[model samples]
Target: MSRVPAALTALTMALLLCSGSALAKKDAETGAEPNTQVPAGSRHYAATGFPDRLVASPAQDAARGFSVAWRTDTSVKAPVLEWVLAGDSPDVGTPTRITATTQALTTELGASHHHRADITGLQPDTLYLWRVQGQNTWSAWNQLRTAGRADQPLTLLYFGDTQNKNLSHVSRVMRAGIKAAPDARLSLFAGDLVSGGDGQDDSEWGEWFAAAGWLPQETAVAPAIGNHEYFEEFEDTPQERRVLGRHWPVTFALPRNGVDAADTSTYWFDYQGVRIAVLDGTSALDLGTAKAQAAWLDTVLADNPHPWSIVLLHQPFYSPREGRENTELRDVLLPVVRRHQVDLVLQGHDHTYGRRGEGQGATPQFVVTVAGPKQYRLSDEARATMAPVGEDTQLFQVLKIDPSHLRYEARTVTGRLYDGFELTRGTDGRKQKTELTQGRIAPRDCTRAQTLKGRADRCWE
Candidate 1:
């Protein structure tokens, strides 16, 4: 027998070892398992549809109630949820079971069922474990904590436009935000959760839910309706003629205190002395519902008994991007918000970070932020008016509110604090705002040399 060359043998062994190492690394990164029995006509990510995308939202009363939404295969006729007060161990069994209201629909990914269950009678400041039962399987037990008393302090995680490049880019920021603010009572999204319109794109929604991990199972989510959430009659049609996607109302179990059944996306919920109101900007801008929503907003704010009020919407009254202004929306909603003395207005859709109302006494602080990978140049107007204009950086905001003070911090995707402030209320119900950037990292700006590199530029260090 002829002996093989030693160098050739070594090279072959090295190649095999490198291939094995790469496979191992990929597996560790993805936690993906092989499925040999992928069913026919099922998308790669839609196999089994075994109760995925589980999310918890605030019910009518967050302190005593919570709502959960999940998806399963269409075969599941009667979905159910079982919950119990979580003890110290997973051995706790046989939780109270409740039937979930389900809606069956066919999407681009095929036939699927969406289930929502409103679990009430929960004790405030208590932890509970819950799981959903589908056609023949039950989801793993997920734990959630109820809202505390009105006087208790509250922390909330805010993200702007997790619309483009959700899984590849935005997932890290979502995970980091959840890790950094583990005690946050709720997660607030400033609209454009997905880039696709009319819910025709299942992959984007899948990336969004998958990136969120256990957040939806734990903290409640309040998402506003962005323009991207609406779809035009055809891709060639004008944007102002768009309509609300069918999936918005069915996927989220939000509060129903809006103008009408079709406008339920505009609603409000209170938690720990703070009332958060979400408005459907797409509906208001495109469907001529601005007047109706503004009336509803006034009513909600007038009836609110909380110490702090935060309004969330997609379009900003003070446009952050140049040549992009929603004067109609601003004209109608700004007066109502000012009349009610809203503390903060979180917005998105400009794909940049900006702040207005800094020196205006008693005026609501308006913020525009972007959390996804997509970036846009600051409009000339934004550069002239907005402070700390963030262009190339993905960001998230951590907000803490108490009876006397409200703290706000904006951080990059890599967990660096970029901008922050503190708002203190005086005895006369006036607010004194203070910037909290002492010794903190400065804002990031891209240089001319870096800008030449196109999207590959790393503007912020």
Candidate 2:
């Protein structure tokens, strides 16, 4: 008999204890009671572990094939998801079991596990009710809708950074972001979902999921690996190699198209009429990302034919913070984006908000936003690069892409539109930008260094 690895043995013991407890929770409506308590170190959850913050709800892949992911307290049994299309009646429910899988991992804080289930085989542009089941106990099925077809126009949500106070203030920002774009087809998380090393803890990751709720499950999500996604390391290359990026791939199954040199986590996918390219700025700057990822990115962009291309990453190529600009990534990837006519670049890390117009003949527009509780100040150099900077605490953005034009709006957490613009791409082969009739959403200058420690302040003047 072969001996089991210590980690596997520990996880198995934990899972068995958890399964016994799951068998005890009586079906609320069924009223069938069980006799055991939830095991120690275990919690019942939906475990949408695949993609963390981004949702590909109206995914343009198969007719009605949408994907979802979550985490679990222990090593779970085989993933068997049951789903049925949701109709006019919310009560409509029926579940067909689909096979899924789980992967073991150790996050920054400790050991952890996640599960991802891709639900396919459904009608086009329709809603579906789905839930996860492990150890014979199932999670509540949630409502999700598929994409309207390739030619259909769609709306998506883009936030700056959601890395601070995940469950409290940051959650409000996310909820407000969701409410602001109630009909948004999907969301793009441009890194900083948590504080990176500190946020990699099992509970912090859970808080992030709890904050997003069924959003990531219902809507399709695409997340970028930010600086916070990595641990605090010195010059230990071997240690860094041993600590390969975590929780990302196991949490969301993204389309494998972006920078292949990196993990599938940093990839791109097209939904409806838009092409989204995800880049790994952190890897490119510190790791050996420039060589491998750059080549893959060039190929992906060159081959893409989507009408609009948006690149997402953690660091800003053009920033309000002059010192923080990613020159290396800019040198390697910017030309690709320009050559491929990339439409937008969304990023976070400086914690401030910014937008800069790409040079002549280029359609790519750059934006930096803060989705988390933390914020930063826009220095004079940072302000020189960007137009209106959001240095104070509250900000987010919503992007609506239609057949005629693409609309972008920057808003406060409470649903007030501060900045707005429209990008109209016509047969003339030029994307004309129109500034909308909205007030600026810049942060007040009254903030001080102490109060804005983790957040950005109003230092642009």
Candidate 3:
């Protein structure tokens, strides 16, 4: 063999390395290896093993317990959480550690892991710092405050569907809600958290989590599963055949004391002096869980240990739109609510703002609101029944509960009070409601000439 030039040998080796790299890139893009993990650069938001989508939910007991759920890449087989008392100064000491129960799931993006840990033995009304550990990394410290004992005044923030334009439009509304009620212990989501196909769209979920920011980690969330949570095979398919999204159960570590142990989405929890029951309206109407949920609701209400009771569902009994009537759910669940004299019914799915209830007696007040950019025109029925039907507007609500009274306020995205009311219960058990909005603002009508995206009459067809 003749002696080759040193530069020529180096050039030949570099070309070979480049060719190999190109082949590897092509194989990754084409998924030539089924078991190979997807490249992080190709993933939506490039999710990693470090915790993301952190959400806290009230545990079996809110006063001394709570749970946190987060997602990580598949590489993290066992995730752990560490916590210590939150203080002004950094005190180096051993902290309580808890290992999370994890589930491996393959999403549309790729394989991922969901981890949940229930932390108990916490002190009431105390703040704590916590962080989650992945295989080789740890998340930044997050703060959590336990709920005060019963009879203590509590505040909660309520939001409607954040399914459309979540990151761009809905994020502002949620941030505004948190800023308005800084002391709120929990945030209630009225469902339809995402509006992607089959509810497994990784980008949509990423946007949803990004819009939520640090709020979910700080304040606990109680969410209901809306009709959008269920994916239909075809538009012509029957409602009874709809199926829940694959991410519904794994993403949320809700209370499992519901009627069907398999479905923890429908459950109840008591905080302060109020009892909140989360019902699966989609399951009730489509999955043949109505009767069972009704029975469960009756039993839960009958055995209630709290004076104030509220029901959270995705669909409204009194539909805000013309063709969105959920007659089956109303027929089966309304009777139970009436019998129990439920204090309030918070719902979503209409995409418009509505409020209707009988102020005379024990009828549960109903509210339908939307928090995202998607808006729909209110039907004639909504206009006739709802006191202040709002369209083409995003809103959030704050509810303050005390021993004898409850004050509720609805505000627009910019923090303007749109509607408000107060409920007072007397010693003799007589209840009265006083409307707080006295011609403060007119109902938003999209039919009027309004410019949106450089188009006139954007709210109507």
Candidate 4:
């Protein structure tokens, strides 16, 4: 913001980064408070000429093609992206080279150029080898595959709120999700990829990248904007503006097909038979974009071409915590998705797991999950509305879906099944869900009644 001086801003950012690094060590692994905090040095992932943070993003229609984005220092001259179909022979065909579009991103540490190259006009279910040119060298070729037809069986990896301990604890959940669903087409995130409270911290973003490693390069990632993603708008500061972190735009290169206020955060992508409509609840509640986003979501779902519509957002229609009463959010976006018969709604920000709307066969099944080390207690109000809730655990979800049915499994970071369910679409479009909790782990919460009655067997210690 012009209201804040550059020197003062940098000093504040440095102090915040140092404090954040220290707080990261004090995690919420157990239900009780963690008593640990060690001072850590400021971690600035300074960029170099060689390309880093290379990620592949899905287009509006992933079946047609995808996009690749990477970061390089300013010295990288004429960065380009080269691509060719993956074939039995390594040198089967000549590569098509495209010059990348560059955007200069200046963080608290320094400045770097983020480049994105869009690859379109490709066939579906095809594998391709793509690489990007750095300053003087080229990144290793990565494999990318497009979505297939509507009837094709699709697997997807869904995560919620890897907002803290990204490198230390969240990395295991990310890799486990990939391992559980190796054939997954799109890796979708509900929100809060980082936990930067003040503003953009390049170090946190770097940890997220390192946690995912080659996962994003191999598969496309679609992120719904969370509350934390929106930090103080100082990068483009005129002060008093709470905009999304500057890293989001150039980092992901998502489709610009949503409402005007939050285009990148609130957009949709079609893969096979699924249309993932991403909404920005933070923008809706904070920036007064609720009315506009509701209308846009109605329009998008009104003309939906995909059979299975899954909506992704940071705030949930139902919260696992009592005080997280997002009545405004639910009032605006809930009816739109329900009216359009959205198959599933994925969400985060509660730091817990909950499943609701399974009774009497609801159109959009609501699921709130957490994938990081942070934990939160489930409230009695939340427990009354939602079922099969879990807290103080890191979890990831793997969904196998087709136009007819969806098989959902929630697994812990150590590859243990925590919750399971299946939803089958009826001929008239309503889905009937069957709880498949035969082999699921015990319910994690210890109820007050069970505790008062001294029923040790009814609760998990």
Candidate 5:
């Protein structure tokens, strides 16, 4: 039997804590934060009595309906969302107003108001100008296009985890993706958009909003729940529990069509010809909601009406990181995914890029990517798999889907193509694939990134 001194144990624990904190330094290091929470930035806009953090989200049918949510100082008693169709005439049409549902959230930064407005009854595939009322000012008139008809071609931007240093390192990647496709319809985030979601602080949300500037207001976003979206039960308790972040529903007025057992964060919506099915992996993995989510996923996929279907969540069905596997999640969702033959499954959390399965009818493409600066080790499976896995690089994806074909390109923040594929779907939904490797950049062995100035602290950790 061995016994350690109390003072020695205390010193050891302190060193461990300090070492962990170093990984989350504000500077742009590489590697995954490993469930670290990025601290809040400022309260300047929060106390200004003006609306900020404006985000437009997809409705069950974005063609005719959508939602927008914003934050403001609590002093702003009344906040309203107004919209009008874009016209050739300088004078916009008489704007229709929707009073907002404002809720107050008191975080470490103090009290702020969150306003959400779900609007419907608009014409499909139409361009609209919208803004939210602030104290006496209004946010810039944001232009957004509603989902077009089913036969129309569609473009979308997909990013993995932007969970750490959002404003610094992750912002440019977003800018690059948007620059590549200025008219992208929906921005699909695989989860962990922010590093922290414990509800005690709202600053990470601030950074996220500041990072994207006005992008969120233009392209609608569909977010899934990552583990970081869960809050620590208590500081003193050694055991960790999953509590959904208070800012989630307040940040985005997501569709309410998910399973009744889960909250609004886990829902599916159709945009143009695509059916985006999002699940709450954090809740399923930690809160004993696997069966609930699995059942909902089955029903949602079974009745999908769109030609192209994709699933978004935080955890991947087949993780490419070595020594890490989400068998539980795969078990719960894979059967449903395979049964319905989902076209693609997008995930984050692993903070790396890897893909498994062919992008076809029965074999859906399973992809994991990281847009934030954090890097992770690549798994042997990833190296073996040709979905072209890599490390030490931040990436974003642009996907264009039409009636019978889908073209996808994954590029680094510097605008270099890393991996690409084109799929041609037959009448039966089965797709023939073509690889786009010409001019593709070489892959970096980021799995050992810590050695190279330590990518956010090597993902091999």
Candidate 6:
């Protein structure tokens, strides 16, 4: 093997050694030389605080409860939140205040922290304004709606991979998705939350969170473990890589409805009338820990008692990308999902957008999409298997569900509705499907799309 540059190795080592406090000190004393800790007052606003990664869950039960999550710097004095009902006019009244804070740690990049809190005692289907703060810094207050009730209709946004060009390019797509459904109950990520691999370095995770910003704090997120969350085997000793999963538990406070053995990230939640089940596909597929998760998945599905059931994960079982298919996931997980009458299966890993069809009754619709700038080509056979497919850059789907029917639309980054459909279940126990006539705009060339076999990028084109 070639000799590694000493400077690169030193830089990496120094970054790895710095704790959150040390990183804060480094940021504080940057004007001076190294090896000194600056006073806490010297740090900038962003250095001490920033609101981000907001996601909202649908109003549950009587539409009185919703949740949000975000991240901050370790130096944050105390995390606090204030919220109130939304108004058409700007003169918003004061809201009940809640005080919360997060713990921080250091990685190869620098110091970081995560915060998650559920805002309860809300009015049904009503919009409200909210914001977060740390120390002297305060966040701009945003608005969100709580779930109305069990019989009320609701909309949600679903995405695949936003791992590449996360904060820079992908942010626009995320923002567009937010605007597209300003009242969406929540947004879902089908894994690949970041482009991290092997080394959970700063760039990988920072870009991902930056892409979402305070959206996580504003909404409730159900994140699955994607392949990118894992590192390549070479970076770690064999044993270390085997036990690796994620820091999701520390990031978002999801409902603990999954297998007791699995962590919080791989769990389910009943938001309003929908029972959302999220699985750790990367762990099952790559970590040789499928049995435990599989058994847990079966139990969760068997126990679900909601009007609609949806599953989210990183890998796509009905993949159009070459070598990217998850046969084990399909055989093991799909049957369970089908048996439980799962309404939809959302995923990302192919880096393209597509949806698969089921011939009839309560058949699950499989969708894969990409919100990041990095794009991938789809396989020719994918066109036949999917209702619609898009290459290059694009957002994915916005789904509206009610007791009588389900509607979804797949839009591009430019706000063009590319594909759409509706699934309606009638009183007679028959299911009907209808496809909307949406023309394709900028579908790209995919002659050399990469073939995804494992976690690595296999092709440039």
Best by TM-score: 4
**lDDT for position 88 in model 6:** 81
Candidate 1, RMSD to the unseen true structure = 11.3
lDDT of 1 by residue, 256-300 (tens): 666773465788888888888888877777777888888888998
Model number with the top lDDT: 4
Deviation (Å) of 65 in candidate 4: 0.8
* TM-score against truth, every candidate: 0.86, 0.81, 0.86, 0.89, 0.88, 0.78
Taking the tens digit of each residue's C-alpha lDDT, what string does model 2 give over 1-461? 55677667567456644544454332223453222122234443223333233233323363458766555545454667678767677666566777767677753224445566677667767877777765545667677766666677787888777776577666787788888788876788888676644222444566677778767766767778777666644336655442334666676766654555676547766666677778888778887677677677777778666677788888888777545657888788787877777888888888777778776643677888887756566778766766666666567788988666888888888777667788998886578888776565444443565441122243311
CA lDDT, every prediction? 0.78, 0.66, 0.80, 0.81, 0.79, 0.66
Model 3 poorest ten-residue lDDT run: 32-41
| After superposition, candidate 6 runs with Cα above 4 Å error | 1-62, 84-97, 197-205, 213-219, 232-247, 359-362, 380-384, 438-444, 447-461
Error of 1 at 274 (Å): 0.3
Ranking by TM-score: 4, 5, 3, 1, 2, 6
Number of colliding residue pairs in each model? 0, 30, 0, 3, 7, 24
C-alpha lDDT (0 to 100) for residue 54 of candidate 4: 93
> Where does the lowest 10-residue lDDT sum fall in candidate 6?
32-41
Name model 1 segments beyond 4 Å from true: 1-42, 47-49, 197-200, 235-240, 447-461
Which residue pairs collide, candidate 4? 1-237, 1-238, 2-237
On residues 146-194, what C-alpha lDDT tens digit does candidate 4 reach at each position? 9888889899899999987688788899999888888887899988898
lDDT of 3 by residue, 1-461 (tens): 55575556556445534544464465457644211122322455545877788888997678888888888998887788898888887773678999999987655456789899889899998998988887698888888888887779999999999886677778899999999999998999999898745223565677788898888889888999887777775457464367777678777878878987226678888888888999998888877889999999999889878768899999988877767779898789899999889989999988889999954674588999989877766789888888888998899999999878888899999888888888888887667888887644778877656433333424521
User: For residue 124, what is the lDDT in candidate 6?
Assistant: 73
Better-scoring candidate (TM-score), 1 or 2 = 1
Clashes of 1: 0
- Badly placed stretches (over 4 Å) of model 5 are 1-42, 197-200, 235-239, 358-362, 447-461
What order do candidates take by lDDT, descending? 4, 3, 5, 1, 6, 2
User: RMSD of candidate 6 to the true fold?
Assistant: 7.9
Stretches of candidate 3 off by over 4 Å are: 1-42, 198-200, 233-240, 448-461
